[model samples]
Target: MRFYTLFFSLFIFSCSEVVKEESFGDVTTQQPSIIPAIQVYASNTDTDVKNGILYYKDTPYSGVYIVKFKNDRIKSKSQYLKGIKEGCTNKWYADGKKFEQRYYSNGHKVGVHTGWWNSGAKKFSYHFNDLGQYQGSLTEWYNNGQVFREFNYVNGRENGAQKAWKANGNIKANYEVVNGERYGLIGLKKCFTVKKGQDKVTR
Candidate 1:
């Protein structure tokens, strides 16, 4: 399990100038292809095991990859260099619905990232800069396709009015965050305000 999780620690950087921070914990170093002749995994075939590890192959990588499930279903795919995910990474649900679509460069998430419900409806969409810090606007929707939450971020920290809507489309909550401080209604009411302390926020 630890080894499996290692591949995913792939995203880490400060909200501000994340790309400048680089280094995140123990990075996964690319292992040179030692068994190039080994057949890559095929969805229609049995699971391929190598050295007690699950199926993995180096199929003329050329800086791109498309992963698959044992059933021949596409699982996830991405482009990367030196073990760092670059360009676009895409994944799908077992049912064939897109689950996640994101962009990255040099291991730091950049551009837009989107997710969808199993039913194929957009679930959430957000933007991040080349540094991997949340920027611009972010929004999420209920499974029913109703707006769930809307907010703005700056350097990964909430920096503007944030609003949430109930499934009925009614405003549920509202607030504003500045430099990590929260201010506005404690609940959905239009009145009342509070100020919370500050702390670093991340995606």
Candidate 2:
């Protein structure tokens, strides 16, 4: 009887120790130490950012994502599936104004993407299909809210009249594109003077 009781106590202690070790291992592997967000931005270039370079605890993020400013303001957030960026990824200016909004699927950009100037005016807007092909109107505006240029795209190629406007709202240029080639001159007579068989228009 004495020997049986001792063995039972030893068995209980061993089981508890095994459980504790497994729990600790799981926690350490699942919850990694987060790094400073500034490092992520620094890895990007001066004028643009290339995605998939962000890291969490020295490991690439592969799950739901939320990056915040030092002041606790949300700077950017998005979702990831198996290391591939998915769903809406959004960023904001320091003043809490939205700077840009983009959608991604399977790590590729898709759907409508929009950007705004720091002054709260829309800077540009465009759309791409699920296959990452541009398939709609692309528009850009001056910081003062005047239309800067407008063009149409079909399957990533220009397919219609493309036009530009000056900051003062005057027509800057007008031309047509068919099958991605400049079709003809349809601009100001003083600006675009076409010569016979020359295939050239001077501005």
Candidate 3:
């Protein structure tokens, strides 16, 4: 009788252990699975310039638009609202380095726009107004980190001094614009002819 009792207890304990393991497995299986975020591609979208909007399968798009390189890396991403670019836009090089960044509002560029060379050096910097016209200083740099060009703009036209330099730091073009006229020298021999609306130099 003691042997039978011992056997019965051992069977009950083994069954309880199996029940606990099965209960743990059931909980793990009932847990939710992770889901990835969705991405929209520009190529899959259609532009409607006349309506001033973008469409995806005939529906107005109001999310982030993405452009990717052939290698599946993100090339550019821009925010859109009601089919128009309405926020920050960023671009990246194939090697994953940032190439450019700019802001837009109501489909027009606003604020600062900047670009960088593949070598991680600043390439250019520009500013724009709400009207999408150039405003403030515009500067460009060579890949070797030398200043290449500098100009001031007011209302989309160059106003004030404009300067350009060679990669070796020598002056290439030095001029000034006042009231829609250019003055000073370009290169070594070319002279600027001041015309009513002309801003370029003639040899």
Candidate 4:
């Protein structure tokens, strides 16, 4: 099962120049990708900077970046030390079960994010915009892989009317909501089926 989560952070640089501060702990350097306009913003051991700030300008990267370490066996990983989540960050439980996994964007939580519950019986997933809004394909599922509920948004709020399905493969009902209020041609019955999927299983 896959779960999604969203997280954000604010990084305020004090001056015009970026400082490279080597993070303390046992960090294993993974392969760095060929970043386009090569700009060595900062390093872990720099006198002028108090922290490391890695930046990007349009090129793509492929690899893991081990930045901070809690112990010799594990490390805190991130895709963008400066900004942009190029990879994934994962955490493990004491029982050897994967506890969490979060993707990043410029170190901010942006895009399709998923996670698990403590009971391990349910799964959760959500979407986010760059500035912090649930913006895109958002969905949830039961432990057995059945969809609990699935939806999305443009800026925020349902972009269109909410549509439900019936087992015979038809539109069960459609509701148009505005300003969190339901109104106008308030409801419609199942009469059509545009395409097919699990949504069509009974509809």
Candidate 5:
């Protein structure tokens, strides 16, 4: 009877030790580590982040994907649903200033998107449609708070007047796109001719 009792106690202790070791291993492996924003952006074309969706171990990821700066400050925080980006994704500069704010729905960009310079001045603002195409006016400003550029887009193609200004508020480019052709002036020079299917302004 004594031998049997001792064997039973030993067996229970061994099992408990095994269970504790396994639990610790699991915890360490499952803990997620913060990644850098530059690394994440570089990996955007990889399978894990392809098509604006996020995947982990070949499975759709659903959670907040966060990236940090080298200084440990939060660089960006984006929410994902069933692997697709959803809701607002916010980004910050290394100095903790808000850098960009954009919205996504079902992996597609939607609504207004805005960005700011490190100096806290608005850098750019634009709108996107549900299909991720540019819609409405897109405007950019210099770090000194001067208007830098303005253009209108319809269905992702530039249309109407396009204008750009230098940092000192001097006119840089003033042109118009009509049916995929450019006309007017660009920085005191005549606008270059664009083919019927090649209406694009080079910044």
Candidate 6:
């Protein structure tokens, strides 16, 4: 009788331990670490983060994808975005010149996209439509960094003149745009004679 009682007690304790472990596993499996709103992935791949990389999958049965950078610049950092060639995409230099864009539901480019510098200068800016057409003002800049002027676009064609200036503040350009075509005169700002023995006015 004594032996049987001792055996029963041991069995009960063993069952309790098993139950505790099962419950722990269930809780850990069902609940993941929560991420804040407006922030993208907080936990990726379930693998430990190391060497400035975090990986995740677009779906349970999808190919693994990754986000990589020099260090913890995750917000400014960009990735393949959702394991598709689509979604908010950004490309950048290590020194931080970047081209960033977003796409529509059908994977067509959309909205105001930009190329920028870490110094916050706008290198170029373009607006696009759902069909990936350039449908807005497209601006470019001089190397010394002035507005080289902008041309209005429609269906990826230039529909207006691009007026711009030189680094010396003189109007040095007049460009007509049509379907990425640039034609017409480039203002060289030359001095011209209006009358004899009179000083030349540069135009």
Q: Which candidate is the best by lDDT?
A: 3
Please give the CA lDDT of all the candidate structures.
0.64, 0.66, 0.74, 0.46, 0.72, 0.50
Model 6 weakest 10-residue run by lDDT: 20-29
Q: Every model's Cα RMSD, please?
A: 15.1, 12.7, 17.0, 16.0, 14.2, 15.3
Residue pair clashes in candidate 2: none
Q: After superposition, how far is residue 61 of candidate 5 from its true place, in Å?
A: 0.6
Best by TM-score: 3
Native-vs-model 5 lDDT?
0.72
lDDT of 6 by residue, 29-106 (tens): 121112111224444445333333333432322122334455643324222223333334455555544544443323
Give a tens-digit lDDT track for model 2, residues 1-203: 99999999999877555521111101222222221122233233331223645445555555446556777676776655544666667778777788888877777789888999998899999889888887789999999999988888888888798877778776666688876678555555764654433435566
Q: Is candidate 1 or candidate 6 better by TM-score?
A: 1
Instruction: State the lDDT of candidate 5 residue by residue for 1-203, as single tens digits.
Output: 99999999999877555421111101221222222122233234443766655786576676667777878887887756777777667888888888998878788889898999998899999999889999999999998999889999999999999988777766777798999888876554454433222334433
Relative to the true structure, candidate 2 reaches a TM of 0.62
By TM-score rank, best first, the candidates go 3, 5, 2, 1, 6, 4
List pairs with backbone clashes in candidate 6: 157-179, 158-179
- List the candidate 1 regions with Cα displacement exceeding 4 Å: 1-62, 188-203
Name model 6 segments beyond 4 Å from true.
1-66, 75-83, 91-105, 142-145, 176-203
Which of candidates 4 and 6 is the stronger one according to lDDT?
6
- Pick out the ten consecutive residues of candidate 1 with the lowest summed lDDT: 20-29
The reply for model 2, stretches above 4 Å from the true place, is 1-60, 70-72, 185-203
